[model samples]
Target chain A: MLVNVLNVISQWAIPLLLLIIPLYGFIKKVPVYEKFVEGAEEGFRTAVRIIPFLVGMMVAISVFRASGAMMVLGSLLKPITDLIAAPAEIMPLAIMRPLSGSAVLGMAAELMKFHGPDSFIGRLASIMQGTTDTTFFVLTVYFGSIGVTRYRYSVVSGLSADITGFLVSLYLCHRLFG
Target chain B: MLNLIWLFLLVSGILVAAWHGNIEVVTSAALQAARDAVEVCLNLVGIMALWLGIMKIAESGGLVNALARLLRPLMVWLFPSVPPDHPAMGAIILNLSANVLGLGNAATPFGMKAMQHLDQINPRPGVASEAMCTFLAMNTSCITLLPATIIGVRASFNSANPTEIVGPCILATASAMVVGMSVDYWFRRRNRRRRR
Candidate 1:
C-alpha cells in the first residue's frame, strides 16, 4: 500500500509543481510579456492556418489504415522485424509514419491486452512507444508556423531518427528482456 | 485554394493506398482516426491549461528572466546573433525546459513566442535568418526528459515496467539532437564558405 502511494505521489509531483508556480504569473501580470502576448497571438494565427494541413495529414493516415495497407506492409516486413528484435506483430505498424503515435499505441494496446506485456507484441509496443516521436507531423506544424519553405535535410534526418529508434528499440528489447 | 487541392490529393492518395476494400469501412475508419486525435488532444486540454497558467505566472513573476540570466553564456555561444536580455532567449529556455519535462502542448506557446521574438530579430520580413533555422533545428530535436506520453501509453498497455523506457528515450533523443545540430552546423558553415 505504501509503495503504491509513493508511486502515485511521484507521478503527480511535477504536474503539481508546474501548476503552483504559474499562480505567480497570474498575480503579477508583468508588462514585459505583453509583447510576448502579441507574439503568441500571432503564433495562434499561424496555428489556425496550419490546421488544414494537419487535417489533411490525419485524414490520409486514417485512409491508409482503412485501406489495409498497414497490414500488408506489416506482413512483408516480418523478416526485418524478426531481425531487429521488434515484436513481429507490431513492427510494420511502427514503420508506417510518424504522424499517429496514438493509433500505433492503440494497436499496441490491443496486441498486449490479449497477448500479455512480456509477449512479443507487448514488448514491441513498449519499445516503439519509448523510442520514437512524431517527427514529421510536429515539424510540419512548427516549421509551417514560422514559414520555412525549405526543410532540406529535415525530412531525412527526422525519419532517420525514427528508423534508428525503431531498430534500436527492437535490439534493446530482445537483448534486455528476451 | 491550391493548397487545399494539394491537401485533397494527399488525403486521397493515402486513402487510395491504405484502403482497398469497402468504401464505408475505409471512410468511417479515416473519420474516426481524426476524431481520435481530437479526442486525445481534448483529454490533454486540462494539463495544457494548467501548464499555460504556470508558464504565465513564471513569466510574470520574473522567474523566466532569472532562468534566462543563468543560460546567458551558453546561449551566447550557441546563438550569438541574439543579444542578451532578449525575449527570444528567455522563451527558448522556457520552451526547452518545458519540453524536457514532457509538456509538449505547453511548450508550443513558448515555442511560438520564441519564434515571434526571432521574427523581431530578423530584418528580412519573410525570409528566415540563420539563427532562425538553427533554433528550428534545436526545437525539432530538443531532448525530452520525462517521456510522459510514452509512459502513459505503456501504463495503458499494461507494461509492468513503464519507467524502463526512460533510459532509451534519453539516449535516442540525445542522439537525434547531436545529429541535428551537427548537420545544422555543417550547412551553416558551408553557406558561410560560399559567401566568403
Candidate 2:
C-alpha cells in the first residue's frame, strides 16, 4: 500500500514539474516562447556537436560486443560475480550500463523478458540500471560539446562511483530481495 | 583517460576478433554502431530541445534562480570554485533536480548548459576545472529518488511488485553519491596540495 502511494508520487513528480515550471513562469510574465526557442536552438547545436563523440563511443561499444569480447569478459568475470552472489547472467548489463544507456537498457529488457521481472536476476538488473548512470556517455556528450579534452581525474572518479553503485546494487538486491 | 579507454576498446576489439577469425563481425558492428549513434542523437535532439525550452522559461521567470538559492548551501560546498549566484550554479541545481525526479531527458540540457556556464568562468579553455570534475562525479552517481524508468520496464514485464526496487535503488544510489563525492574531494585536495 505504501509502495503504491510512493510509486504514484514518483510518477507524478516529473509531470508536475513539467506543468508547474512553465505555469509559474507564465504567471511571472516571463517571455516563455522566445526564451524557449533560444534555449532550444542551443540544444540543437549541442545535439549536433555531440554526434562525433557519440559515434566514437557507440562504435567502440559495438566493436567490443561484436568481437565477442563482452561475452569473453562476462565468462571470465562469471566466477567472481557468482562468488559474490551477483547473478552472472546480468554481468554484461552491469558492465555496459556505464557505457551506453540504450544498449544496457536493451540488455536489461532482454534479461527481464527471459527471466521474468520478478526473478532475482531481473530485479537485480533493474536495480543496477536504476542506481547507475551512463558514465562514459555523459562524459563524452557534456565534455565533448565544450571541447574540454583534458578530463584528467573525472573518469577515475566517475568509474569509481559506478563501481560503488554496482556493488551496492548487488549487495542490496541480495539482502532485501533475495 | 578517455583516449586510453577508446584505444583499448579498438585495439582489443580488433585483436580479439582477428584471433577469433571474426573480423567480419567487427566490420558489421562498426557500421551498425554508427547508425545507432545517429539514431540516439536524433532522439536526444527532440528531448533536449523540449526540456531546454521549458528551462529557458523557468530561467527567465526566476524559478531556476529560486531553486538555485534553495540549493545554495549545498552547491557552495560542492562547487567551491563557482560563485553562489553564477548561472552555472543554477544550471547545476536544475540538472540535479531533474535527475532526482527521473527526468533524464530534461537533465541533459541543464547539465550541458551548466558545463557551458562553468566553461565561461573557466581559466583554462580546453581543460576541465576542479568544479567540473566534481560536478561530473556527482552527476555520474546522481542520487536517484525514484528509478521510474526501471519501474516502467518492470511493469511492462508484469512484475508482481514493480516498485519494490525503489527503496533499494535509493539506498544504493545514496551510497554511490557519498563515495563519489568523497573521492572527488580527495582528488581535489591532493591536486591543490601538489600545487602548493
Candidate 3:
C-alpha cells in the first residue's frame, strides 16, 4: 500500500519539478540554458578521467577469471561461503562487486545457462540481480576524484556490509526457501 | 608505505590460508588472474569507447544540459553548500544522472568535475569542506533507479523480464544512501564537536 503511494508520488515529482524550475528560470530571464551548458561541459570531462582506472580494474578481473584465479579464490573461500549457504550462482556477485559490470554479467549469464531458470540457484541469482552497489569501484572513483588519501575506514565498512548481506541472505535461503 | 604493508599482509594471509589445500594452484591462479586481467581490459576497450562516444554526443547536442536541469532539485538538496547557480551543482546533477541510469562508466568524469568545483569553494585548503564530504557520501551511495548492467545480464541469460530487478535495485540503493548519509552526518558532527 505504501509502495504504491510512493510510486505514484514519484511518477509526478520529476515531471512537475522539471516544469516548474524552467518556467521560473525563463520568467526571470536567468540564462538557464547557458548555465546548464557550462555545468554539463564539466560533467563531460569528468567522465573522461575514469578511463584508466576502469581499464585497470577490468583487466584485473578478467585476469582473475581467465587464469582460474577466481575459481581458486572460490575454492579457497568455499568453507566460508558454505556457512552462508551461498550457492555457486551468487558467489561471483561477491567477487564481482569490487570489480566491474561486464565481469559480473558474464558470471550471472553463465549461472543462468548452467543452473536452469527457476531453480534455487536461479532465484538466488535473481535476488542478487536487484541487490548490491559496487562498493570498492564507487569509492575508488569518487574518493580518488577528490584526492582522498585517507579513505580506509569506508572500505572496511562497505566490505563488511557486503559480507553481512552474503551471510544473512545465505541463511535465509537455506533455512526458509531452499 | 603503510598500504604496501597491508597489501603484503593480505597476500601473505591468503597464501597461508590456502597453503595446505592447494598453494601451488592458488599461486598459478593468481598469475593467471593477472594475465586474464589484460585480456578483460582489451574486451572493455570498445564498450567504454562506445558509451563515452554517446556521452560525448550528448554533451555536444546539449542532452547533458537537459539532464542537469532535470536533476537540479536533487542536486541542490544533496549539495546545499554549492549555490544554485554554481557550475559545481550542474556538474553534480549530470554526474548523478549518469549514476542513476547505471552508467558508472559515464559518471566518473562528472564526479571529478563536481569535486573540482567543490574544491574551488573549499574554505580549508587541505581538509575537505563539509559539503565536499557530504557530496562524497551521496555520490558513493547514490540511489540507482535501474540496475542497467544487471538487467542486461539477466536479459542476456534469457530472463523473462530483465527489468524486474529494478524494484529491488532501487530499494537497496535508497536504503544504502540513507545509511551512508546518516553515517556521514555523524562523522561530520563528531568532527565539528572536536574542533569546537
User: Best by lDDT, which number?
Assistant: 2
Of the two candidates 1 and 2, the one with more favorable TM-score, higher being better, is: 2
lDDT of each residue in B108-161, candidate 3, tens digit only: 666666677777887765456777667666676677775655555565667665
Clashing pairs in 1: A22-B54, A25-B57, A67-B18, A67-B19, A67-B20
Candidates 1 and 3 compared by lDDT, better number: 1
Poorly placed runs, candidate 3 (over 4 Å):
A1-89, A152-178, B1-77, B123-130
Of 1 and 3, the candidate ahead on TM-score is 1
Stretches of model 1 off by over 4 angstroms after superposition: A1-49, A72-87, A147-149, B1-54, B122-129, B156-158
DockQ of 2: 0.74
Second chain alone, TM-score for each candidate: 0.76, 0.96, 0.67
To one decimal place, how large is model 3's interface RMSD in Å? 6.9
The CA lDDT at B37 in model 3 is 46
Residue lDDT tens for model 1, B56-169: 557667888899999899998788789888878988898777677776676766776677678787767556666776776666666776766656656666677766767766
lDDT of 2 by residue, A1-178 (tens): 7557767887787788779978888899987788889888988888888899889989998899779888788888887887887777878887787888888888999999999999889989999989868999999999988989899999999988998999998888888778
Better of 2 and 3 by TM-score: 2
- Residue pairs that clash (backbone atoms under 3 angstroms), model 3: A46-B109, A46-B110, A47-B109, A59-B37, A62-B36, A63-B33, A63-B36, A63-B37, A64-B33
| Number of the candidate with higher DockQ, 2 or 3 | 2
lDDT of 1 by residue, A1-178 (tens): 4335435755785767656564555566655345335434454455555554455566766666666656666778888766765555665457553656657667766776788766655766665665545765665555555665455555545655676566666666666667
Model 3, A2-98: lDDT tens digits are 3344345545644564565555555655566665555455444444454454444444444445444556667788887777667655776667654
Interface RMSD of each: 4.8, 1.5, 6.9
Assess the local accuracy of residue B185 in candidate 2 as a C-alpha lDDT between 0 and 100: 93
